[model samples]
Target: MTATAVAASVPVARGYRFELVKLWSQRRVRLLLLTCWAGPALFVAAVSQQSTLPVDTLFGRWMHATGWAGPLVTLGFAGTWALPLLTSVVAGDVFAAEDRLGTWRHLLLAVRSPRRIFAAKVLASLTVIMLLVAGLAAGSTAGGLLTVGNHPLVGLDGHPLAPADAAGTVLLAWICVLAPTLALAAIGLLGSVALGRSPMGLLLPVLVALGLQLAQMMPLPVPVRVALPGYAFIAWNGLFTSPAQLGPLLIGITVSLVWAVTAAGLAYRIFLRRDFTDQAYDGAGRRALTSGLLPLAGVLVVTIAVIVPVTGGPSSGIEQDKVQRSVATAFAHLYRLQTEQLHRPAVTEVQLDTSAACTRGGGRLEPQGPGNDWRCVVSWHLPGVPAAGSATYQLDLTPDGRFMADGDGPKEVNGYFLVRTPAGDAPNPLWQFDGTVALLPTVPKG
Candidate 1:
C-alpha cells in the first residue's frame, strides 16, 4: 500500500498493539514493575521490625497500633519520590527511545499519524502506572494485615472504624492518589517527547516535582498554591481527618486531570511537527542535545536571574518594619492563648500592647531575609500587674512568613507556652500545651 493510503487508514488498534509489544518486550520494564510491587512489602517489614514509629507523619503514631496504618504511612512516603520515579521510567522513555534507536523516521511512515502513536504510548504508560499504584496499595494492605494485628483504625477524625470500614477508606485514599500519579506520568511523557532523550525525559520530571514542592514553601497566595499539582498530591492527607473533607480531594483530581491532558496534548503536537528525516541531527547525540537543550537552559537561566532580583529586592524582601509588625501580631496571638491556658479573663489583642523592640544579636536591627535570628525585648501587662513587665525572646523567621521564637522570660521558658498553629490561627489546642513554646509579652491597654 502507498504511504498516502496507509496514512488514510490510520490503524489505531495496530498502533496500540505495537506500543504494548514495545513496552512488554523490554526486560527492564519487568524489573521496574517488580521493584515497585515489592517496595511496599519491604517497607512494611522494616517498619514492623523497628521498635518505634516515625511519628512525624499523619499515621505514623498509630502505625504500631494497627495494621491499617501501614497503607497510610506507605502512601505518605511513596508519594514523595517512588511513584514519580516508577511512572517516569516508562513514560520518560516511550517516545525518546524511538529517537535514540533511530526508528522515528521509519515509524513515522508506518504509523500514519503521530497523534495515534502518541495516544497509544500514553495508554500503555498509564496502564503500567495503574498497575504500579495497585501493586503498592495491595502490597501495603496485605503486608500490614499480616505483620500487625488487624485491629480497628483510629482515623484522624478521632473516630474508630471496624476493619472492613478502614479497608474501604484505605482504598479510597489509594484511588485519590491515582490521578496525581497519572498526571506525573503525563508530565514525564511530555518531557521525554520534548527533550527527545531518555536521560532528560527521566530526570526532568523528577526535577519538576521537586521544584513544585519547593514552590509550596514559598509565600505564594493560597489559591495559587492550591492550584499546583503538588498541592493535589499532598491534599490526600485530608481524607484521614474526621469528617473526611472531599472538596480538596475532588479539586486535586480535577487539577491533575487537566494538567495531564494538557501536557500530553502539547507533546503530541510537538511530535507531529518535528521532522524525522534528518539523519545527521537524529543520529548524532551531541547535536541533538546542543540544538534542543542549550537554548532552553539559557532561557531558564535568564528567567531565574530576572525573578530573583524582583522578588528578592528590598521592596519585596523581609524587612525590619515587617518583622516588628509580624512579631507583634504573632506575640499578641501567643499571649492570648497563654492567658486562656492560665484561666485568666480573655483580653482583646488590641488591649495588649504587643510593641516589640527587635534587634539582631547585640547590634541594631538590620533589614534581612528569612532564616535570620534575632533578639527582642517585649513589654506587656500581666493580669493584675501594676507595672509593665519585659521579657527577652530569641526569634527565627522563615521566608514563608512563618517564625519560631524561644522565650527567655521568667519561669515561662521551661514550661508549656503557645506557638503559632499550622493554619496561622491562635489558641490552637493541639500546640497549646507544648512546654517548649515561647511567650509573647503584651502590655495592658491604658
Candidate 2:
C-alpha cells in the first residue's frame, strides 16, 4: 500500500473535531453550553444592579455598570463553580455518556485505535473546557459592548495597559487559573476510561474537586503548598498586582500540564488493557469498576495526604495574603513614657478607606449619605481579607489604659496599631466593641 493509499485506507483521525461533532449532536452538551453563557450574566445581575457598574479603570471611558459583568466573570466566582463545573458537566460525562447510551462498543469499533480514540476524547474534552472559558469571557465582552459600548480597558494593576492587553490579561488569568481545575477534568476522564460507566467517572471528580478545595485551605508550609496543583492556581493571582509577574503562574501551568498529560496516558492505557481483565465483574459488553477504584483511591489518598497538609499548614504567599489582614490596627506603646513623650505625625491628615472590604460583602459605602465614607469590611466567608487604604494611626493607649503613647516615625510607620474610634462626622463606625487589632505593618519585618 502506498503512503497516501494507506493513509486513506487507515483514515486520518482528525481528533477533537470529530469528537466535538459527536458531542455537539448531543442535547446535553448544547444545553450545558447555553447555561454557561447565560448563567454568569444572570448571577452578576442578581448580585448587582446594571446601572451602578464601576468603570474598569480610572482612565476607562464612560461605560455602563453592567460592564462589570466582563471583569466579574474573570474574578474568583467564575473560577470557582462556573468554569470547573462547566468543564465537568461535559468532561465528567463525556466518556460515561456513551456508556449510558450503549454506544461505547460501536464508538470504539469505529475508531479502531484506542490511543487515537483516547486522544480524541481528551482533545474534545479540553476543547469543550477551553470554549466554555473563552465563551464566558467573550459573552461578557459582547454584552459589555452591547450594554456599555466597547472602549479601552484598564488592567487590575493601575498601569495603563492597552485595551487589548487588559482584555488579554484577564482572559489569560482565567485560563491560567484552570491549572488546578484541569487535573479534575483529566482524572475524571481517566475514571471514564477505566470505570467504563460514565457516572462512576463524573461523580468522583466533583466530589474530589469540592473536597480538595477544603483540604487545601489548611495552614501549611510554602514548599508543601507549592507541591500541590491547587496551590499553584490561587497563587497565580500574583499576575494581577501592580508589577505583573508570572513566575508562580508559569510554575502552575507547567504542573497542571504535567498532571493532565500523565492522566491522559493512564486513561489511554486503561482503555487499551480493559478487555484483558476478569470477565466476572460484568457481562460481555460492560467494563469493570474494580480496576478503576483502586487507582482512584490510591491517587486520592496519596494526593489528599500530600495536599491536605499543603492546605492545612501556613499559607503560601497568596494564601497568607488571603488568610490574613494587612492593615490591622494594633495598640502598642513604649514601656515608659512621659506626658510630652507622645507626639502624633506632624501632618496627620490621614484618610482611612475600608470601602474595598465592605464592598466585598455586597455592602456599598456611600460617598456622602448616612454611612457615607464609612469603613466596614467583609470578614465572613470572603476570598481574601480586603486590603484597607487611607487608614492612619495617631495614638496608642498605654497597656495600662492610662496615658497615651505615640511611637516616633513617619505617619506611614511600619508597625501594628490598635485603634479607638475617635468621633468622625461620617457616622457610626463599627468597632470591635472593644478594639480591633491586626498585624498590618507598613513594612514587613526583616
Estimate, for each residue in 134-163, the C-alpha lDDT of model 2 and write its tens digit.
667666655555555445443332123455
TM-score of every model?
0.64, 0.59
Q: Which stretches of candidate 2 lie over 4 Å from their true place?
A: 1-17, 42-69, 73-75, 144-165, 276-446
- How many backbone collisions does model 1 have? 5
lDDT of 1: 0.64
Question: In terms of lDDT, which candidate is strongest?
Answer: 1
lDDT to native, each model: 0.64, 0.46
Instruction: In model 1, state the lDDT of residue 430.
Output: 22
Could you tell me which residue pairs clash in candidate 1? 157-242, 380-442, 380-443, 381-442, 381-443
